[model samples]
Target: MTNTEITIHTDGSCLGNPGRGGWAATLRRYEGGKEVKKRSINGGVKHTTNNRMEMTAAIQGLKKIKKGEKAQITVYSDSRLLIQGMTDWHHKWQTNGWRKAGGKPVENRDLWEELLTVTDELNVQWEWVRGHAGDRRNEEVDAMAADAAYKAA
Candidate 1:
């Protein structure tokens, strides 16, 4: 298993509550002047949340890499809430049996747990990107996600 570092961009969109939603992830690896781009999408769901889409993007991206290969991935997303929850509050939630403080069940616990499992399989470094503000790759992913959501509707 060769160790390769992949720069990945991800985005997700939801049309309305219990409405259409989608998530897209793009993986790019540059060798000299050549860049390989691979995209994946998840849709076809009747009811979903934007957070679920966001988490799905990350999970799908991680799912692409082969096992036992060292992957250094930088995942870009505009969702600060998702990033913080994964890097910060997840520990507390797990210790508390996936419940938040005050003993309330956490939102999207299933997706969060799934994401954690997929991410743990690889070496991922999560980063933040401002959505719809002209980052070309991120914008492309945003378009893909929106289209996927609409198509699934």
Candidate 2:
């Protein structure tokens, strides 16, 4: 993996809350002009929630960064649930033994753990983008996710 700083746009889509779901991540950078790299990650599951799909998108996208790559990745997502879960709630969840208040189990604990582990292997910066705001990268990933969901359905 190149050491170049990578900007990633991620998104998740679902045909229904318990129906086909998809996730996507698009990596972008142009430090080397025509030689610059652009890569995308996208997939779907038959039964899932939008939140789960959102988490999956982050997981798959972050996993694309090789173990040894020192690339600093900025992940932009339209899902506030994902962005806030990672940036805000995850630390508390860890401290609480992955439980929420009142001892409720954290939802998507498996994916959250995976994301944390992968993020530890790289420099990651998370940001939130408004969905359907016409940001090119965000739109691209959104479309990719929708397409993946369509295929899965």
Most lDDT-accurate candidate: 2
After superposition, the stretches of candidate 1 with alpha carbons farther than 4 Å from their true spots are 1-3, 31-37, 40-42
Candidate 2: residue 129 Cα off by (Å)? 0.3
Q: TM per model?
A: 0.87, 0.90
For candidate 2, give the lDDT of residue 19. 88
lDDT of each: 0.80, 0.86
Off by over 4 Å in 2: 1-3, 30-35
lDDT for each residue of candidate 1 in 31-146, tens digit (9 for 90 to 100): 44356555555554567888888888887877786665465678889989777887798999999999999999999898888888877767778888999899998898899888
Cα lDDT for residue 111, candidate 1? 88
lDDT of 2: 0.86
